[model samples]
Target: MTCGLFQILMISFFHLIELSSQQETRFVYETFRGQENLYLDGSATVLPSGLLQLTNALHHQMAHVFYKESIGLSSSRQLSFSTHFVCALVPQPGVEGGHGMAFVVSPSMDFSHAESTRYLGIFNVSKNGSPSSHVLAVELDTIWNPDFEDIDHNHVGIDVNSPLSVGIASASYYSDIKGKNESINLLSGNPLQVWVDYEGNMLNVSMAPCEVQKPSRPLLSQHINLSDIFPNRRLFVGFSAATGTAISYHYILSWSFSTSRGSLQRLDISRLPEVPHPRSEHKNLSPLFIVLLGFLAIMGFCTLTGMYFFRRSKYAEVTEAWEEEFGAHRFSYKSLYKATKGLTRMDFLEEEVLEKSTEEISFQTEK
Candidate 1:
């Protein structure tokens, strides 16, 4: 009876463990906007001149997708989105100036923001008072703004509603004195990649020199509740670039997203056809080592299970032997009273004293 009960409990526990391993459902959409094709082969070139801008406009809008009435992104669910771009500025003689780039998420998807020169990628508010109409942009700006030019070349900014509010919030000193305040170095084409994460009420942004390396801790964090900007719980995400007639090219190699409960899904990063880059080289353990570890783990689990069963079996055996020898029906109130010589408290005390004396005698004999 004990063995049967133990087996049933073990089976029930294992079934619950299996149920927790089910995969979660996740959905993803990706679009690339630019003049050149973004590819995986690491061959896409950044425009030396003309500006390129790509907007999701008609393909996939955020408001149409993630909402309580749409995809049902409630408090219990979470969503993650990220994109990768390669920005390189080739030497352009006396024309050293280059435009910066931005990643934007806003409530409105219909209207195109006005061009604000270097700030064109960010929202440009109309003359009317509608700052609360929509919120847009976290910019990785390279150029310096006099209003917030406390630092040097590479800087980060957050823009909302209009270009008037578009200025640097965080800036990194330029590596070279000549490169100070310039968004891109015209001589050497150095590439930069940025990553953004928004979960619950928090927003985080990070940047990496290459796609293979781990992203640095968020450069900036804001406490604004995402529910405010995305009241409907959906946001349109895309990139925008412009050059004020100063030509240049922009390219996005890849983009992807994952939900709080789901696995990562690949994103389409190019409107033009291009070859994919080779996978990044990183140290990972061999599959054989993983299999060996799994085998050892299984063996350890079995050993522990066997020990438990053996101990349980021993306890059951002892109990069964006691029941057989004593006979469950044999022990009665009269038998107990006779064993103690009388139904008196003094008789019971004397019986305990005799048991102690017998144990001492047995111990002395063994020694």
Candidate 2:
């Protein structure tokens, strides 16, 4: 009798699971603007222009932004999701390439265990390739990493838990007119629209420049069972960016996600926030440089003031042309000062008389 009851309960649970899988969740961010629905960490922030700026031109740093709430069907263990977003990867000044960014679906928001690196905040060297990670990342990588077995320096990859990609392709799109694969520069600083769709066991990633619409063919595609990856069928979606020795700025102008096929919200490219130029109106001077500049200014001011006072206090005797012409017959103030500096006038007169007498005696001897 107990076994019969257990069988009935199991059947009812299966029926509930079937019903739960039909629930759809949608999140669209046309512009962050004044919205506070995202949880940001590290160097992530929303620009005043309603853009999501991830990492700045800082090296060895990482930043991330996630939806404030977890996204998943509460009663289902399988989810078919699609996401669309417009993003920009601007190269730092004079930098050719850089570490990259990723669109990640993680089980939890706590990534302290995985230190940021070439992994793009997905996993560390130790945690990578471990099934326990339960992370899915669509990487838009710029820097070539041999450790991760990257295909090239500029490419898009589908990473499950490790930086190593299961499906990879150059950063480009298929042209219907050309009937071939054409390459695109990922670090061109231009906005690009990306679509990630996962239905059944197939995952597709497609992208094109903002000017170009979605291509008929995907840039890269692969078949992977997401249900097995997400043990609990729950996920959190976000953007993760990392920098190495090189620097780059990652940005997201808009993003939308949906569980229904072909129903992902489209971004308003015309109204999207612009990616600020690589060089701002003013340069960013470091704190140390500012302090040194201030110190130098203070020292220069002190030196100038000291010199001005010294010149003012020193004595200067000015002699006119008339004084110079008749100085032999006239007693100038300088002559008076010399005669009166130490000896009295009477003593000076006596010296002059002795000199005259000596001259007279010499003249008589000569005669």
Instruction: Evaluate residue 299 in candidate 1 and report its C-alpha lDDT on the 0 to 100 scale.
Output: 100
* lDDT per residue (tens digit) for residues 180-246 in model 1: 3223332133445455666665666655444234334455666545555566655555555444434
**Per-residue lDDT value at 233 in model 2:** 65
lDDT of 1 at 11: 93
Q: Name the weakest run of 10 consecutive residues (lDDT summed) in model 2.
A: 310-319
Model 2, span 246-312: residue lDDT tens: 7788999999998886788787778878788667556779999999999999999999999997765
